[model samples]
Structure formats: structure tokens, C-alpha cells
Target: MEHPALHQAMLKSTFYPGEAGPVEFHETHISRLYLTHDHVYKLKKPVNFQFLDFTTLEKRHFYCNEELRLNQRLCSDTYLDVLEIRQDGDSFHLGAGSGEIIDYLLRMKRLPEGRMLSNLLTAADPTLPGEMERLGRHLAYWHRTQPPVGGDENADLERTRRNWDENLRQSAPLVENLLTADAQNRMREEVEHFLTEQAPLLRKRQSTGQVIDGHGDLHAEHICLTDPIRIYDCIEFNERFRLADRLADLAFLLMDLDYRGRRDLSAGVLQAYDETWGTDLDAPRLLRFYKSYRAWVRGKVLGFLAQDPEADAATRTDALARGRRYFSLALGYLCRRPSLILTCGLMGTGKSVLAAELATALGAIHLRSDELRKELAGLSPSSRDLSAFGEGLYHREATERTYRALADRAELHLAAGRTVIVDASFAEKGRRDDFRDLARRQQRPLAILWLNCPDELLLERLRQRRGDASDGRPELLAAQKRIFQPPCGESRVLPVDTRDEVAYNVQRIICHLANPEFLKEQP
Candidate 1:
């Protein structure tokens, strides 16, 4: 900033190599980026933070080379080299030409601006879902090839403890200013309990190479949807953040998508990722656990930006609001008290669809009665034996037994401080009453989302519902309608029309969860 002549020379196209039209300068919280016609140069700021040190020229050069090497693994064509800036008496040069070496710049080929993941997401492109599938497969193979750094279970667990402790310690000062004490308490308590209870499982993952070197910052802005998806800007100064559980990596992207209000894409991406790799990484509430961590990290960084002395007043104010938003997102992923959400209606009212969508949005456990009933009856979930209405596996006794098991699983998860969403056809009053009693005894809040549809729509849906876990048929609708005892006077019931968009319905459900009295209605 002091060298006005050097800065002016760098801005002109003449300073760059081979016909660069003009140079565009951009700055982030830690780095300065200069974009030429076909190439880009990045210079790290000489700033020392608690997590990273780039205060010395030597340290900056080391990290520049490190960034080049690490990023080349995923975006080989983009990362060219770490070039040196040299200086003479009263002038500075871009390349390794003469005089004394002043600084280092990570040079790269400029990628297409249109292909950036963040831009495409904002445009609401339909092809993004297929791109995400490809990206997931790419990440799966990339994950397999990563070098495992010290794959000792004990060491990994202890390191995890220290990392979490450091996060809590650093963010403690902004308890009331950035986030509420209740939100912080929930995060600290749930994280500790999860780490302690699932220590063996987590350590097993470490022993196997599921925990390895990963892209520390997997934000959408760092990804490009090229012929092969390119992910760049991995943390090079700190292996402590880069080396982590693979789920934590996925959690970063998932949390980023959620923060951007693209949970639909996040859900699809997870499905593809899980299908390509295994689902061993998906523990109960584990994604949310890691997601909360990722969101908190973003919030903490934003807090730093807000307090930066060099930042403008407008920039600081924007950072403060965005930081609080990130903290709120983190809080949404945690539960101070577990909740029991039941989805009950006739068979064809879109209960399963809503349940899955809601669970993905809230990171809650989704239990479907159809699957559980088949599991109990020792039948394949896809096997559809439409025995006479209310007979066979759908018999009164068998149905009650399945509901009891469903309730049992819900109770287990709720007891462990996790929210549960149970999808079932609560046509009989006794089953509904049983759940109400369970909620009462557990001392947890309850909400029965009673899905409703027109008779013709319900019949049409039942007729067209094929290859599903449900054995319901159009003929069974009349029987169900007759037996269905609507939650007419129940204070815990909320009627939901199943014809809405999943995203809108998810937001409605989230709002309802935050304030139960927001939209109470009898079914």
C-alpha cells in the first residue's frame, strides 16, 4: 500500500505477461487477489491470527508453495506455480528477474466466472443436481487417495477434544453479542455428550482412514463446475483444520448449502454421496453436529472481520449481521430439548415425502411406519403384498405392534437429545393417544402434523403409488377414512396441506417448531 508507483505499474496490462487486458484487484479478509486477462495472482496478507501465521515473508512464501501443491491435487490445470516478486532501488517487478526477493504470489489460470458453484446456485440452474452427483463421485475417489496423517485413534480423539476446546475458548467472549448463552450451552453440552458416547465409533473411523486430509474450507465459492469439478483454496497453514473426518468435509458443503437456502440441493448431494460411498459416516445427528461446528467457525471468522481495524464501517456492520445469522444457523442445528414430531394422516396424503424433506432440513431422525412394519414382519421393504384392507401385516394387532416399535425407536433417540420425525397413518385413536402419553411421560414437546388431501387426490395418489414401501391401495382409502379419528380437539395437532412446495413446507415446519402456537389447528 505504501508503494504507489509499484501499485500503479501492477495495475497496467504491461506489467503482466503476454497481452493481459487489464488487472483487477480484489481483497478478502486475509488475501489480495489480482486478476489479469488469463491469469490470477494471490498474495497472502502479512497478518498473524490465532489459527494461522503469515506475518513473515518466509512464512508467506512457504504457504504460497503449500497452497500451490495442495490445490493442484484437485485443480491441477489451474494452479501454475508460486512466483516471486523482486524489487530494485525504486521499482518492483512481478517475476523472478532481479534484485532482492520481496514477496511470493500464487499464480493460477483464471477459471470461467459462470461455472462458479455460488453463481450457478444463485441462478437456480436445474443441471446443478446432476453436477452435484458428479462432484460427489469425484470427492469419493479424492477421499480414497488422501494421505492419512497419524491414524491413531487415541491421538485423533484427543486432538478432536483440543480442537473443540479451542473453538469454545476463542468464541466465549462474544456469548451475548453474537449468540445467546442458551445456544452456546446446547452446542457445548451436545458436542461433549456425543463425543463421549460415540468415542468408540469415531475412533474406529480414525483407525480406518475415514479421517484423513481434507479440504479445510469447502465453501461453494471455492468450487467450480468444470468438466471435472475443481475445488480449491484448501487450508495450507494449518494441518489441524485440514486433517479431519471426511464427514466434517461434507458437513462444510452441506452447511454452506443450508446457509444459502439451498437445502434441496444439499439433500440430493448427500443421497448421491452416500450411494457412491458408504453411509458409515452418517450417525444419528452426526451431520448436524459437524454442521453446527462448521457454521460456528464461519461465525467466529466473521466476528474477527467485524472487529478488524482496517475494515470499513459498512463492511464491519455487514459482517456483524451475517455473523449473527451464521450463529443462528448453528443454533438451529442444535436442540436444547429434544422434540417428538409425528406425521399422521390417511395413506396417500404425502406423509413420507414431507417427513423425509423435514428430516433433511432439520437434521432429524425420520422413521417411516411402512419400513418399520415390514422390518417387524420379516418382509422386504419393497415387497408389496396388498393383503385385504386392515388384514395381514396391516392387521390391528400387527399395526399396533409396529407403532409400538416405532415409538420405542423414537423414545430411544429422543432420550439421547435428538429430534425424531415419525411418519405413520394414525387412523386409529388408540395409537395417537399412545404417542400423546409417551410425549407426556418423556416431558418433551410434541407436535402431530396431520397431513390432509382431497378425497380424489388421496385416491389418485394411492392408485399411482407404486414401487414404494407402502402397501396401501385406492380401495383402502375408504376404509382408512372411516377409521381415521382426526385430532379434532388436540392442542398438539397442526394440519398441513401436502400440496405445497417442500421448501416452503420445511420452513413452515421449522417456524412451527420454534413457536408451537404460531399456527395451531385441529385436524
Candidate 2:
């Protein structure tokens, strides 16, 4: 359609006044789109395929209406309504009129594409870690509210199996023709093994209520980070595609992060989600499975592009190479597993310094109880006053509350498959017991390193300490020592004297954490 004609025709409509202006058209894989000042109008291409059908005008109109309805559930403000394009002589208008309607278009309020999370990340003007955390919490809340798909476990398994099977089957011909024999064989074997080995677990996820109708395409591009982080463009046409293991939805963003070389942000997102959701959820397995599935889906998309007759040789070759890279990345996830180490010690005894160094060495999450306590108390680490301990902050009765909150955060980081160095005084036997309990629950190894310093040295260090979150005044050191209860004989403790060189103390902690058996006889 000509832009001038469309613009002139749309201006006559009363649906959106002042919002309609010049129509800007763009083409994509599936839709012919037009953008106005405040709305986007998307018309489905009249293409017929086994996976999708928009050949007939009526079918196109129905799906257009369906798109508006389903998308409005999540993006109610953005998705305005559906409007049919009616033929008036040679040109078409955007409402019911005299001539036959040949096409349909879904109308929506246009949002600034620059506000997308992907664009924000690329620009790097604003940090999105906090926003991503909030987004994770929101998604968890949404998932909890969704109704579970009550069906037989085998049926759910079969549905997922068919989905994957069809996707792979469609992409196989292109892989065979385009990729080298070795690459094609590797892809086939890896994908087949992944599905075969993880089938039962996938079924278990559904039966255990881990599956839901989620945003099928959850890459950063589809997410807009305004005030509330609007997630739009959910898969509306296919229920089987959208109704999936929630991990699959999460993996899309993680895979995008990996592709963009932002593994740190990926780790942050996974940690936030696991923390908010309160479930172990077999994150490592889910990560691997979903990453591979996402890679395969990307490969399929690339293959489709390669098959397009209009695509030049260079474009096809580039698409095939990109597909191969994604497959290799999926395999990389399978081959590598990072080891974890948990550290424990008293506050202001050089534990934070040691933990920070080790975390840098191992690329781990340096989770400190001090930080968590402050966070739970609604105080920033830089805050000096005990204002965090007001009615909104810490209370005598809220001691356990703070500890549990800390433990919950620690659990999320641990579950996301990261080495966690927990720095805390661990002054009480119950606190140590709680950590031990967490270790047992997580089925991950734990190591406790006690930083021992002479009373004189501790006092000196405390006196020298300038500004820190611990808020341990020099005068309080003596009082803390008086009330301090060291780890009992039953508890695992690797004592390292802080008077020694910092590197030496850190090495000793690392050695003990790496070899718990050697430290078992120490205390």
C-alpha cells in the first residue's frame, strides 16, 4: 500500500484522533507494518504453511483479532484494537466500507523502540541490573497467578516432544544441505541426546506445576523497560508454543545475554529470578536445556532466511554461519560446569577482603551477611546511622527475619550455579547451624573459614577501619569479643590468622575450601 494513501485514509477514521499522521511502512519476516505517530498497524502476510496459515482473508482477520485480544492481556495500554482494511476502488481504508475487505491489520499504540531493554543495554547509558531484578520479581508474580495446565504427565511430555520434533524436522533439510557433514552430524547428535536425556525431567516439570503459558519469545528486544517493565509480543497464535516450561522462556533472555557477551548480567537475572520464585527448579539443567532449545530455534530461523529466494549468497552464508555459532554455544553450555566454594568468617577480620580476592579469582558471587542485613533493614551500605533499625528497619524481634532473608538471597545465588563466598561474623551457633542446614538442603559442598586474630590485632584493625557497612565502632570490638561464641568442635572451621599476609590467608581458605577432608581434622 502507498504511504500517502494509507496516511490520508487513516486520518479519516475516528478511532484515534490526533494520534494518526503520516504512515510509515516497514517489512519483516511475517508482517507488512505501518507506523503512525502514536500507533503501529501490522498486517499479516498472505502466506500458507504447515506451521502457520494466513492465506484466506477471513483467517487473517481472525488471527488479527486474536492478536489484539491476547496481547491486550499483557499490553493493554499498547494494544488498542483490530481494524479491517476495506477496499474502496483501488485503495483501501481502515474500516468497514463499500468494497470487499482483502486484508486485516492489528492496531496498537506505538511505544518508543529506544525504550526497549535491549536498546538500553546497548546504549549503556543506564544500568539495568536493578530494573532486571524488579522484572524478575514481576514475572514470578505473573507466573504464580497463571492457571496450571491440568493434564496427564505423559500427554504434556508428548506435546513438548512434538513441538521440538517438528522444529528439528523442519530445520534438518537445511542443515544437511548447508552445513558441513561434521557440523550437521554434531548438531543432530547433540540435539537428539539433549531431548532424550531430559524428557523425563521435562515431564516432571509439568506434572510438578513448573510449566505455564509464558512469553514464548522473551529476548531483551521483546521487553520494554518503562515504569513497570512491559513484556509484550507473546506468542499468540500457538498455545503449544506458549504453554511451555517456564525455564524455556527464561532461557531465551539468558541465551541472548550469552550471545551478546553479557554473562554477568545473565547471572544477575538468574539469581534474581530464583530468589523471588523460592524454588530450586533444577536451574543448571533448565539452563542447559533451554539454551540448547533456543539455539535450535535460532538455527531454524536462520535456515528459513537462507531458504528465501530473495536472499543473496552472502546473506545465506552469513545466516548459516550464525546458526552454526549458536549450535556451538549450546554445546559449550553442555561441556562446562563451574565449581563453587562457600566461605565463612567473622566480620572485620579480613574475611571480606579475602572473599573479594577469591571471588575475583573464581568469578563468584561475594555475598556478605553485612550487605544482606543492611538491605533487609532497608539501609544502603553507605548509610551511617542506625536509621535502618527503626520501625521500618531492624528490630530485636527481627533478628531471625534478617538471617532468613540473607539465607534466601544466598540460596538463590547458590542455586544459579555460582561460587558464593558468604562473609559474616557467624557469631551465634544457631547462625552457623542455619548455614549448615542450607548446605545440606542445596546438596552443595560448604567450607567454613574462621579468621582468627589476636584481641590486640582485632582491636587495632577495628580502630583503623574507616567507613564500612559492618558499622562496628572501635569501642564495640571489646564488647563483641566478650559476647562472641566461637564455632564449636562439631562445626567445620578452618582457622586462618589475619595477622599473616592477606594473600597467604586467602590461599589457606581456598585450599581448605578445595579440600574439606584436610580441614576436617583442624578444629
Candidate 3:
């Protein structure tokens, strides 16, 4: 019988125990889950594809067994058993008997949809970080105990290439309808470049036995926050998909957090995992490659669904939008090259505040010139230097020394692959030119954030300022304004009105940074 006919037959009241009012049917590419009162019956669709095949009853039965066995590793109580769907004369039943077995169903206990990690994270539960910590620790313990997947060095590299090729191939048809042609080309170029450049690291990881049998799909949606914290829905049909580098598995969850706009949570997960695993993992070093790969994979799947002939208009539209978002996210990883941001303004123009906000938002290092100068002078950051404007601790010699020190420290951070924001007055055009030269010499992207405020506002702010790292007073504002040079003719210059709300101005700066034109103009 066809799937529609089988579905109709199975929907009858005789097939289930409770009153058959309504059944929640959720369909994916390979299976249909019929959720009832206390149970969920998953029936695999008769589909044949490059990665999966379930076109026959025997294959369905075998896969049902595989699903049950694989998912039991993480969610033993939820995945119950496989049941034989029997066909009687002009009727269908739920179990094996004298009738012919038409198909198989993986019967499972129904889990609360709201308890899924995705839903809980969306609700912003206070305990999410703690829960994520526990989850990370558990994963660490699991990985340490799991047996290794023995494979030749070439096996995984070949698999990686194949996966990338498949992603590009499958996503080609939807380039015009979903992702733009330029986006597709850029994603391909970035992926190829990353694979070529990181090949040695990848090989070293494999040689050191970093690859293992792991849960192939580790997104938040597949995890539940129940008492025992059940995680389910592992890739069962393909062992090649399940066995991968442990970092790749971790990347799935981290990428999901990024997709959900929870980068802080992503950092928390990495920190907890690193702590529990006793591995000083550099998340920033390798996250972009894996995140881009995972995002492109998601985009490929959504693009496929968008172009699927059987999908309805609403489904196709949703898939297209989602595919575009994932494609954009993939491009973002390419655009996120480390930057040296110069926050320049007069003394009371909120340069420090802008730098702090941007650094926090981008998870970059905030190196304030004022704090570094005080530290160099053997004084606490809060210790006010009451010297004359350009004498004693604030002399030209000390100022030059502070600027030199800031430049050196910024390069150190840049060499370590970090974004650095240097917060300073930068009133001297020579100092500004020096920073511009430094950016060029280091081959890093540079952005100059010039915070401007009206003279009255600046005066008021300076007069009211107390216990600041900067000793700038209202008396210094007039002299600073006469000497301060506004950034001019720089393509990366982003001027902000410091009188505006801090959050609003910060978001405006971030928006500018996210622009494709701006990123493409980066040197």
C-alpha cells in the first residue's frame, strides 16, 4: 500500500488504545511521527536517497531496530521498542500476528515538548547555564569512556571532502531562489580555503585519536532537560556520519547556540566542556570553520526542502527564508576576521564606554590606554593623577611611552588572533597615523570609531565625571577640542554621537560592522 493509504489505515481507532479524537503528526524527510497520549509511533517513509535508504519493508524493519539501539545509548527510557505493523484483509493492526507485516514502527514514550533544551533556552530559564555545565560534563565523561573509531588517516579526510562536495552540489539548484549566486560562490571559496589551510591540524587531530564514535546530531532541539537529561536522535543509518572528531560534535551544539543568538551561552558551554575534559581547548581558533560547515549543511538541507516538489507553498517559503539565514550565517564566519578597532574621541566623549560595549558584544579584548598608563605608572586604575595636563605622569614622554606600550600590547593580542579595541583620546593625528600604519603592517582590518558630542554635553560630562581612570576635567576640554582631529577620508571610520543612548549607539556601530560592503572593504 502507498504511504497515504497506510497512514489512513493506521489513523483508525482500532490501531490505538485511546479515544481517537486527533493525532499530532509531524513529518520529516525520512519519517512521520504520530504522537498520541503517552506514546509516539515513528514510521519511516519509503524513501531512497544518496545518504539513506528505506524503500523496502525489510530495510525499514532493520532501520527501526538500528534507531532503537542507537538512541537507547542516550535515551534508554524514551526509546522503547520496534513494533511490527501487520496488514489484515482490508484492515491494519499494530502488532505482529497471523497477518502479513507491512512495515515497522519505532514505538517510544512521548517526551514533553516544552522540556526540550531549545524551548527551555528560549524561555530563558535561570538555571540554563548550570544545566549546560552539567550537560557539558556529561558529554566529556561520555567521550572519555567511548571506544575509538579505528580508521585510516585518509578515511576522514576523504569523508570531509565528500561532505563538502555533497553540500555544494545539493545546494546548487537553490542558489537563485534561496541563496544569491555571490553568497554561494563566497561560501564555496571560504570552505575550500579553510579545508586547505587547516588540513595539517585536521590530520594531527586524527593522528592523536581525537575522532571517536559520538552523537552525530547534537543540537539543542535533540536534547531534553528532564530529570536525567535525555539526549536523543543520533544518526543511526550511517556510521560514517556518527563517527567524527569530538570537536565537530561539540561544534554542532555551539553552532545551534549561535543560531539562537546566544553567543554567551555558547562560550559557557565551551568553558564548561574544557574544564571538565581537562583540555585547554581554543574555541576561537577552530570554531569558525566548524560553524561555517554546520551552517552550510543546514542551509543545504533547507534549500533542498525549499525546492522539493512535494512541499507546499508555505513550507517552501519558510524553508527558503531559513536557508537564506543559514547561508548568511556561513558568510558571517568569513567576514569575522580579527580587527583592530581604534576608539578615538575627546576626553569626555564616551570613548571608553563605546570600547567597553563593543568589546563585550564581540567578545574582544578591551585595552584602555588610560588603565595601561596608570598601571605603567605603578598606580591603581582608580588612582587619579592630579598632575598638570601635559606634565608629570601625563608628560609628552609618558604619553609617548603609553602609546608605544598600547601599540605593542595590541599587536600581541592581534597575533593571538583576537580583536583589540584601543580606547584613547588619539587627539594627535600622528598617533592616529601610527595606528593606521600598524594595522597595515600587521595585515589586520582596522576601524576607527570617532565618538563626537556637542561642546556643552562634553563640558557637562567632564564636570560631572568622578573616580574615572581618566583625569580629564572641564578645564582640559577646551584645549583638547582645539587639538582633536576628526577622522576624515577613512573608509572604515564610523562616527557616533556620544549624546545618544549607549545601547542604541553601540547597536548602530555593530550594524555598520555587519554590513557586507564594510566587511568587504576591510584590508
Candidate whose lDDT is highest: 1
Per-prediction count of colliding residue pairs? Answer: 0, 0, 0
Clashing pairs in 1: none
Query: 160 in model 1: Cα distance from truth in Å?
Result: 1.9
Model 1 alpha-carbon drift over 4 Å, by segment: 1-5, 281-285, 336-444, 447-523
| Span of 10 residues, lowest total lDDT, candidate 2 | 514-523
Task: Give candidate 3 misplaced runs (Cα > 4 Å).
Answer: 17-22, 280-284, 340-444, 447-523
The 0-to-1 C-alpha lDDT of every candidate, in the order given, reads 0.80, 0.68, 0.79
Candidate order (lDDT): 1, 3, 2
| lDDT of candidate 2 over 85-160, digit per residue (tens) | 7677767656666877666788887788888888988986456777778777777777777777777776567776
Cα-based TM-score, every candidate: 0.67, 0.61, 0.69
**lDDT by residue for model 3 (144-213), tens:** 7776667776666667777888888888887666666666676677677767887777777677777888
The candidate, 1 or 2, that scores higher on lDDT is 1
Question: Which 10-residue window in model 3 sums to the lowest lDDT?
Answer: 503-512
**Preferred candidate (lDDT higher): 1 or 3:** 1
Report residue 519 deviation for candidate 2 (angstroms): 28
- Residue 510's C-alpha lDDT in candidate 2? 40
Q: How well is each residue in 1-523 modelled by candidate 1, as lDDT tens digits?
A: 2345656777877877685586899977678888898988888888888889888899999999999999999999999998888789877777867779878889899999899999999999999988888877778778878877675687667777788888878777766666656556656776788799878877887887778789989989999999878899999989889888888888899899888877778877787778778776444457777888898898888887888889999999888877766776676675434678898898889999888767754667899999999999899999887688889888889987998899899989888877789899887677888887887777678888989878888888888887999998987778778878998877787888878644345545655665534323222
